[model samples]
Target chain A: MNLIEKYAAEVGKYLPSRNRADIEAEIRSTLEDMLEERAQAPNADREALTLQLLKEYGAPRKVAESYGAVQYLIGPRLYPIFEMVLKIVAAVLLGVGLLGFGVNAVRMDMAGPALVHALGKLFVDSFGGVMMAFGNIVLVFAVLERVLPLSDQKDLTDEWEPADLAKEQDPDRVKTSDLIAEIVFTVIFLALFNLYSQYVGIVIFNDNQWTFIPVLTEAFFRYMPWINLLWTLQIGLHVWLLRKGMWDVPTRLINLAFKLGSIGLAYAMLIGPAIIKVNTESLAGTSLAEVARELSPLSQFILVPFLIAMIIAPVVEIVQTVIYLVRRRSSVPFPVK
Target chain B: MENDELIQNMVFELRRGIISIAVLSLLGKEEYGYSLLKALSDQGLEVDQSTLYPLLRRLESQGLLQSDWRIVDEARPRRYYVISPQGREVLAQLKKEWASMTESMQKLLS
Candidate 1:
């Protein structure tokens, strides 16, 4: 009915139902006491005094918040990591979406309505991607906050030792950028191999029309299961390395195993039938027999050499990893400070 | 401005730490919220009503204080708080700690 009562009611609106009545009664009593003390002055207007006392108490919502226990969808412990992940995901989505739009726009007639249409599509697509990424990330963090155990949560704030500082600053520390790049590439590779295998081809522009000629044959699909497993493993490894913030012996050994597995798969593919379709019918202005002859040498010059390089690259990595492990063993470990 | 803010923050933290002890000491005698607040202010330890009221409820919930409503002559009932046995024990411990902390600080400052 009066200013104090109205203020208490407003504060009670923000408070939980269980304690609202009791808290409101307490606030009203305190307000009355303040009013009584203030009213002892000469010519004290009761209404004016009530308003002044309420103002000093703070906003109704703030008063309620002070009384309530602190609640967070994502608490301070996870906030920095959540923010970092959100930034990376949003940036990647926006970057890739816009890049795709840009390429398509450039291929269109620049002076026509098509370019404007493409620009509009670009805005809408990029906005949708960013929103989806943000929502998914927030949902994940909220779930993590609820399900993460108290002990595991200590990883966010546990004190670091001098040895940790040494490990972080070590010259051989795994580069975050390199690991991130590997993650991105592995994801793209997996998506293309599994989801868009049919679209893996060479685009030839002829007579103002673009034709996508299928380069990879059914033989490529045969290797899909193995390739998918390797790519998924690589992604998991990169994510672990990122969380660890440094690579140790076990990580290097896992990296070595991945390289060895990749080489073995590449070798298997090379020894098998040609993986490229080589559809002679798809060759424009050429007879089937002539096209077939042309494909035989092209496969040798292209596919064979490509497979050999894949094997050689992994062999080189294995040697380097071995050398790194040997060098690490001889070096003195970081002394405790 | 920064120095003033730093001092303000430090003073606030210092006051916050001792406010519970001050409240418990005053509530040794059963008093309603307004009277308890007035009693503290009269002793030169001014506290905001919003802070004091919530703190009283929290202490009560924690079993450090007990409260009951009393009605007088058909007027608005008042909720009165008093320090519990547990509160008295805690207050004694706090006083001992405060005395030792002040002694150590005095020596360090000197």
Candidate 2:
């Protein structure tokens, strides 16, 4: 149509479909009113003035944005399941990558720099594969986003209370040994941290004698009461889980609490201060000197960040705990007399 | 420049809060979009076209304003907006609120 009509149509492109036609007509009407008023002024050229009026009004996209048309591709209703599926896909990709890497390494019969070169190349080649996998997932979710109607939100949403996970025959039964093992482990860990924290440091046999460097900061000790409370409650939770012989709501909740506490404590230690110390000078003339330089002082007194793998263990454990908590509740049936 | 921007934003917010009341008060007499803009401007309440049209549509959607597309004086069709019964009741309450608010504000400012 005309220039003003074209501008209105352009603005209509970004408006929500329900309001698009009505808004476009209103915009065209307003623009004509503006043009008529401006063109009546002295030295007014209708074509030049219409162009300036549209320019002053702003770009089509921006004018449309001012109306606040928010459309989420994958809304909150599907986001949780999307995240779980994404995590599963990532883990599968990592597993496949490792398998391929192992097979390639075995077949090549390469060593030293050649193996390192192959490993580096493997990572570089992985970028394309990861992008493709990620793209496919997003496409699937985008389709699902539009296909799922608003009426089905209640049926699909996680508003319902989490159900009890146990089967009728043995739903409430706790694997007794798991709790016992955890209790023993936590107790020994508490003893090591609380009773003998000073011995928990880097000891080097230098000058034909052992020298221990104390490295736990004040921040680390300040966290001790909270840490002690968490571990003690952890032991108590295990004991209660055993005595009860099943996970009740309260038991699971307490476990989640202590689990959160441990997470908070670990996160604080990770970000706050060096909870453990190592002396590079002490490790001089030793192979560990380079490693000591690589390792940041861990804030975990009990976690014993000797291996980085152990630090990650707590995170993996908490994730599984959350899944377990979401899946199961105490659903024991009363017996008939 | 920054202070000017800040004051402009604050003024915008102030107008946004009260523009509804002003529109409802004036819409006792039916006015189309351009004519309503003119009426508001004539009363020294210069509202943006973008802001006013959307507001008219929204207020209509909310059942506070009634509108219909009609041509007058053999001219082009325009959506004429008038206050709904609900809008009159809301405006009556809002006038009392505005009076009370201005009284307190005057006391604070003085």
Candidate 3:
């Protein structure tokens, strides 16, 4: 009711329901005692002064935060790691969510009228849970990492000697050899998965036997049967890391390369044939007519970047990998064990 | 190791297990939140209430500590915590382990 009581209620609001009333009473008494002490001293407006004191101590949230250490899924000491995890989680969630929606729409549209309702139900039923489960697991792991941190940490509140605080930290870099193997494995897997799924969907569903063995499709799937080797390689790489008890600069660099390669492969799958068709048409016809006709109206704008993503983007990944590995490794201790 | 590193390591090591034991031992006698913290700190353990409170909540949630709020102070109600039967069993096992560890470490030091 009064200023002290108001502050008491505010603090109580943040506390657990069971403890609220008692904490509120305690806070009220404590504030009243403080106000009485303040009143004994000279103050212009005693009542207003009490209110000012309460405000300075801060609102309920600040008071509660002070009482409890500011905890996150990742604490302040490991915030960079937390932030990275958050970014990866958000990206993965967004990517998966979009993929689910795309798959749902495509599968729904593709189904015949007889199976339309059934297919729609089946697709939603199967994938909706998968997407939600993945998000939940990501959230759980993020929280776990925050709560049970894996990194070496120093209490932020500890006073530090400048020499100790400023001492150079030698960071471990991701191993390049490990990364190369991972990337090679990942890219091959991605390329193969793309070719296989496309082959299966385009060929088997095309409802034609002869078209299934089309020279283009054969060349594509044939060139990349080891695509699933991505899975084997990734498992192997992780096993190796687990065994070695560390993954530093070189591995991260390779991972970046692999990611770039995947994006590149995706781009190639999207539009590589179009470019080939265009070039072949021009060569055969001795003119741009056939090429121009066959190329979609917006094809060049789309496919040029697609090609760049396929070729140049992987190169960018290599650069990013180098930069990331160099900076992070400089501070990290090696052999994470 | 030097004195500071040794102390630091000891503090960190104590931190890993002490909270569990302290909570168990505190609850072993009787269960009350602020009083328990005061008692521990009074005994020179000096644990922050911030850490103690959350640890209490976590232990309760994990079924190691059972708690219920009672209107004991008349003016202010408070939650009381008690070691569950299972918690007592765990505490006994932990005590045995601690004793053995201390014995071994002392022997090695000697």
Candidate 4:
């Protein structure tokens, strides 16, 4: 084959398979055109002219890239979200893993090999969590980049308006960080509640053994369906708020409903049969009756205060929502200087 | 040399955006890849062969241009491109936009 044919073949290797033949044909024709223009001298060798034209055109890969179909595992449009998601997931995973390790280390003999063993476990678990998070995030974004339409992939390419700046300057705009944190925590809570409910308990280290005492009673389990429903709703609300990037009336109303539902669940748990059942016999040096009497007042101290906060927090939110509605209605400009 | 490279790069970017409009406007008269390149260069657009060929395929794919291959009795076959009706409509709109933008920029600079 001649220089023009060789050049076209080399460029074809880099092109997408479906259009390779057509593209190579066009490139060859264009190369001939360039050669004819350059080799205007009467005695110019055609082979030398072809070589000179190919040099000026560019390398095969560079010429192919000019077609503007560069391949990407995760494209620019999805890259920012992918990066943010990976960071948040890694942070949450590392936090939980280290907290578990710290608790286990405290329970172990500090001077012994047990502490070393706990540290090793922490390293392995945290590394595995981070790798899994990265892989999953990349896979999800790759799929999204493939499936999403050009219009939907507007995060990178959308034309900005002055109104967008005004929206950014809005004082009552929803904080993305807060919404992401809520999403992460709600997902963790739901996963543990549904799949690992047994681990959601109190553990005591006594007599060189770890004793996991069940804290939540069957009555608590009974209320879980409603609690799970509310948690799911809250997660949905947070995700929607994240997508919207700002809080409006409808979202606030939805958030108000979620708060009320959560309060109701908390109230039900308070009024129901006792949720924590501490087996006093498992207490290292204490008698059952003595442990029970001591624990009763302590449990009340924790539970009663928690219940009050649950109710009060939602009530305060409801009042605040009403005030915000009134303020918004009065045409008070946002982002007060 | 650095300043020359910078100017070349800026001019390249400026030309890239209008290359489609330029090509579409010229292909109102049917011409193959090589002739079209000659026509554009004659008009002082100076588009590269590689860039022009790919752009023609892309515009054709986007339904803005149509192509057909013709073979004469003693000549190698050549694929010719012509502006579609769709291309004409888009070209008109682009020309209006270009006019308005030039006027606006001129005012701003003055």
The model with the greatest TM-score is 4
- Return the top candidate by DockQ: 1
Better of 3 and 4 by TM-score: 4
Residues A174-212, candidate 4, lDDT per residue (tens digit)?
A: 665456556655666676667667665443333334444
Which 10 consecutive positions of candidate 1 chain B have the poorest summed lDDT? B71-80
Model 3, span A188-294: residue lDDT tens: 33543564343221111112111121113343564353435544556555544533445565565555655665665666566544322222342355343443344
Evaluated on the second chain alone, the candidates' TM-scores are: 0.90, 0.96, 0.84, 0.94
Candidate 4, number of clashes? 0
| Model 4, C-alpha of A202: deviation from truth (Å) | 7.0
- How good is the docking of model 4, as DockQ? 0.45
Question: Model 4, residue A175: what's the lDDT?
Answer: 67
Residue B76 in candidate 1, Cα distance off native in Å: 2.0
C-alpha lDDT score of every prediction, in listed order: 0.74, 0.72, 0.56, 0.74
For each candidate in turn, the TM-score is 0.54, 0.56, 0.34, 0.57
Error of 4 at A81 (Å): 6.3
lDDT (Cα, tens digit) per residue for candidate 3, span B18-84: 7778779878767566677667877788765446666776787788898876676463445678999
Error of 1 at B84 (Å): 1.7
Model 1 per-residue lDDT tens digits across residues B1-110: 69999998898889888899899988888998888877888998878776787788889989999999988666578997899999999999999998999999999999
Report the C-alpha displacement of residue A14, candidate 4, in angstroms.
12
Off by over 4 Å in 2: A75-88, A112-129, A147-337
Give DockQ: model 1: 0.53
Is 1 or 4 the stronger prediction by DockQ? 1
